[model samples]
Target: MTSTPHHQPILDSPYVLDLFAGPGGLDVAAHVLDVPSLGIEWDRSACLTRYAAGLDTLHADVSAIRREAFESLPPEINVLAGGPPCQTYSVAGSGVGRKALDEVKGYIERLMAGDSDEKIDKELQKLSDPRTALVLEPLRYAIQATRSPNRGHRPYDVIVLEQVPAVQALWAHYALVLKNIGLPDGTKYQVKVGVLDTETYGVPQTRSRAVLIARRVGLGEPFLPEPTHQAYEAKGWNRGNGEAAALTHQPSLDEEITPEPVTRRGKSGGPLPWVSMRMALPGRRKPFLVRSNYGSSGHPGRRGVRTDQQPAATVTGRISRFVVFEHLDENVVYEGPRFSMNEAGMLQSFPPAYPWSGTAQAQQVGNAVPPLFGAHLLSAALGLPVPDPEALREPWVPATEEERAKLRSQGCGAADDCTARCPRPEDQAPPRSVSQKKKLSAG
Candidate 1:
């Protein structure tokens, strides 16, 4: 890789095109690693955020951009990445996709059996939730890039896809298809598919996602990246058979937990002591509790609670609904300030001042692939050295005013509703320094 003082790092195959890109999470990781990328996202809010963050974006649906358009694009696009919308497949949402799993598998089988896109799309229209078919868009793109006539006449050097763990089986099908397909040069792809725990990648949240990675045959065999941090396990809670047992109460403070040396190795030989909410959001004078909006153990009223010392529960679009409590003793509660956009973004491993624009900002943050985790995935896919987790953990500075201005000049800011959608400097909260003394409730 080569980089200049004023330019991004240029790799042998630097260009990436991310389909169904939500708020440029993977794009942020690509930028950090010096790989230039463009994201295609239909959500206006997500596109606005991407523009605010100075990311290359095309505000269009993945399906709308057909194979011809893809083939017409610059041939330097060697990497294809995406995390398709997972609402239908998510256990937290409607079980429409789960119910239609067999239908989807049949479609995949047809695609592998040389079925045409038009036929598959026609069959997909019969599904109850159309979004269920979006999961296969990545596979469609992969097939087109490799088999269809294009400028390069070569397959994408690397391909990465991610979605809810419910889509793991679908990814397995994708792995099979990709492995069997070859480029005009007879070079096939090496594929790996599995579910990864975000916490193991040093994210300050316990979210699991199914990921698929593919590389050209000649490139080193494709494999998932190894863990860089220990997975989060509740200190005093026992979880078995998907049931949470009674909690052995402990103080919700960093000092309350036994201090394990950071240098210590985990069972996976990764760093010891998983990152906690306290570590991710510093400068808090007191520990606090986050009460999730959703229920736990099939009890509607029993809201899930995680102390600052624990890694946060999986963040979702409903994050704003979660209540933060300065004090919670049984039923009694003292409500505290909720996490700011910056804090939420930080937990997702985005830069502190990643200019979040437009409405449903929390949803944008929640839907993102944690940049740190994305970095690891991209590194592994591109045959690059894994980045230092500690370096990624450090506070990230906000984009400079000049940089933001440049983005705006390049048509990155929200159009038509700039005043309402574009993020202001004051709107962003910088990472709190350790030396700064502030209450947990302080904004």
Candidate 2:
């Protein structure tokens, strides 16, 4: 593992336990900031990457793990963090495309009813898309952790959860549930939920996620972390004048759909430039078309081309579909070169020296919470000092032939190491007898 330069642990309860911790994004951030952390992930490929990175992880299904099992851990895990698989909740996901929201709402209601584990499991078997309910796992774990025990409960001091923007309302509803149900200490958990753009947190990507945070009795209501970086639009940028907006590294496609630019220093001024693709990829500045796996049919969505000057669109699991758009000057666009695994990793803020061992390299990278953004959230949750966005950028360079050989020496691929591969979420036919709208309304 590469050495972390400026980490100072300062949380009331610094130990963090991450659920659905794919590729250790939150774990990486917590650890680098000197917080003791543990990750639980079921995917073998994800576990392999976690292992190669030297992160502490439990290679088992999150559903199978019980809170009592955490008794053996040290420092009394006070923070609970998770980003359950978002495949079912993403706008680009097949689940949403299939119009599964009504069924999803029913699942949430069932979960809220506090159905028995056996019943929930059986219901899951019946659902066409069980992954939609996986979002409840974090809340389930939290409730289990905070229940009064024969022995005094070690209630989590803070809880942080994130998902795609489509799940924002679900998390908001969860916040209300958490508020209604008091912890073992008979204190209501203060909760906050919202949507945040990754670029605002200095991630070199234009991804938006739904965030939910809860703090124990005394801490009061928690707040979402404020953005430390801005891109696309600066507060006072005069579009009429030639003067560019703050951090306008990339050209906007259109005014209607474009994300407003931001800067480190609000409307006034900030020193650092947004970390553009050019800054991260170095030397690969030409424009290019990112071919879609969907081809011309364009069912889910069309693959997009990104310029070196801007943060990239959300990186998807199928990143191989995104080929670079080669071009001459600004007008001519060509297609062909695809992003290497390392390039994707850098954009996600993984350290340059990270040992990557996984079959679906792009999938693992795409699924990760960017470590820089994670750190920003962690700092906010713990009331610690947030790092400067400028300080977060590390130089990314292509692997040399020798480095490639060493990576090979690490392991074949996560496929070989992982005991089980996560399957695509199935679409279960909705219940015939019970009315879907009625069930959702019952909650």
Candidate 3:
């Protein structure tokens, strides 16, 4: 009998290129639901994501990706995903070090070819392979940051681009860069920059992002993704015609989010539901009386403080080492002013049993992406079923009895709550899996 070539699955999940992958939070989320992903990360925690998932991984910077690598790959890599190191615009590390998105601005400028080939090669290394990058940014930062000495000194791309409300201003800089490089005002790539909340999309935190959608296909103004969940509305925008009542009456930001989708002569979907802090990563008990320090509140001149009763602010690649908890002696535990690495990562949403590898001397858990948050974003993009809130109640694996007590006292509903915080069942997970029987290879 003659051997035949194997046919590929048409419905096979699209391959993804994770850029500036950090600790692969985005890849982990997509992988949890079975989305095929290839990640490029300069950091070790992100490399561990591939090892944990039985997938291929490359250690490199995103901007440094080698385009020649793609010539040999399959054509199905439908998506290029990433949240490039937002340190330049991040609210947490906003110190004297290139505050207010300066570094990201520089990165983007380099991305547009204004920088030296060597510099671009260095930054591009953040990606294991080469592909166009999609950036997420706020309107103000978008415009102000992209300003260069060569700018003709005018906001561009406002013509064909549909301004995603709230952060339309943020698009000023991004739009300008494309225009300055002589790219036309037409479909440079589907760009949508707006202030979106996770709660409105059915996640808990009141996180708002200046999301931008880019498609290499040159489709003019990528349609604003139809929102599946509804929570808040702008002060005056009316309900979209034909929006479902179930989606409109959300208890979220009350009237702060966009109302039900009402169509003008044109429109397809409504805003996503805002999953309140209570809904997404909800606690068994109510959070303390506080809004959110989610933005740039941690800046020195800015006054912001976190309390034990509240879900933590967004967890980043570094700070995963600090543990957070409430003291039965009330808030006494916090008085010590430190947390176990395991405790901090859990609050940010890593799974309870996922193993991490690195020396204690190395920042293992600190270099991670909150898997839960990453998963939710993937669900929205792939149109996969959302994670059932109740089903997410996995018991965390704990390191010690004291850690167990810490979770129990905090009203943990599952045994794994402790482990979810640390992810290391034994010591830590490494970039390479211990199970030698298996191997991860690239297509």
Model 3: per-residue lDDT, tens digit, 1-443? 01112322222355565655554456666666677766665554444433443444555433323322323223445554555433223233425222333444566655555344456546645642122122332222123223422333222222211111323343546655654453322223334345444334333332345544433233233333334456443221111221122123223332232212312112345443433323323332322222222232122211123433123444433343333332323222222334344444444455444445444312444344445545544444444455433222354332354543442333222333332322233432223433442554431
Pairwise TM-score winner, candidates 2 and 3: 2
lDDT of 3 at 20: 53
In model 2, pairs of residues that clash are 128-427, 128-428, 230-262, 232-261, 233-261, 233-262, 287-325, 288-325, 288-326, 289-325
Worst 10-residue lDDT window for candidate 2 reads 294-303
Task: Tell me the lDDT of candidate 1.
Answer: 0.69
- 2 against 3, candidate with superior lDDT: 2
lDDT of each: 0.69, 0.62, 0.39
lDDT of 1 by residue, 1-443 (tens): 11112212224766888888889889988877788998877676787787667787766657766533666556778898989876666544455556767677677666656688888888887776677787878767766765656555666778899887888888887777667854334556788898888888777888888899887777667778777677666543422211112222435434443323333257776466677777777744455667675543233323477766777777777777777765454334477888888888887877666778889999898889889889878877876666555545455554455655554444334333344323344433334433453654464
The C-alpha stretches of model 2 lying farther than 4 A from their native spots are 1-10, 67-75, 90-115, 148-151, 183-185, 231-267, 270-273, 283-303, 327-336, 389-443
Q: Is candidate 1 or candidate 2 better by lDDT?
A: 1
lDDT of 1 at 95: 56
lDDT of 3 at 336: 35
Backbone clash count for every predicted candidate, in the order shown? 0, 10, 63
Say which candidate scores most in TM-score. 1
Q: What is the descending lDDT order? A: 1, 2, 3
| Quality of model 3 by C-alpha lDDT | 0.39
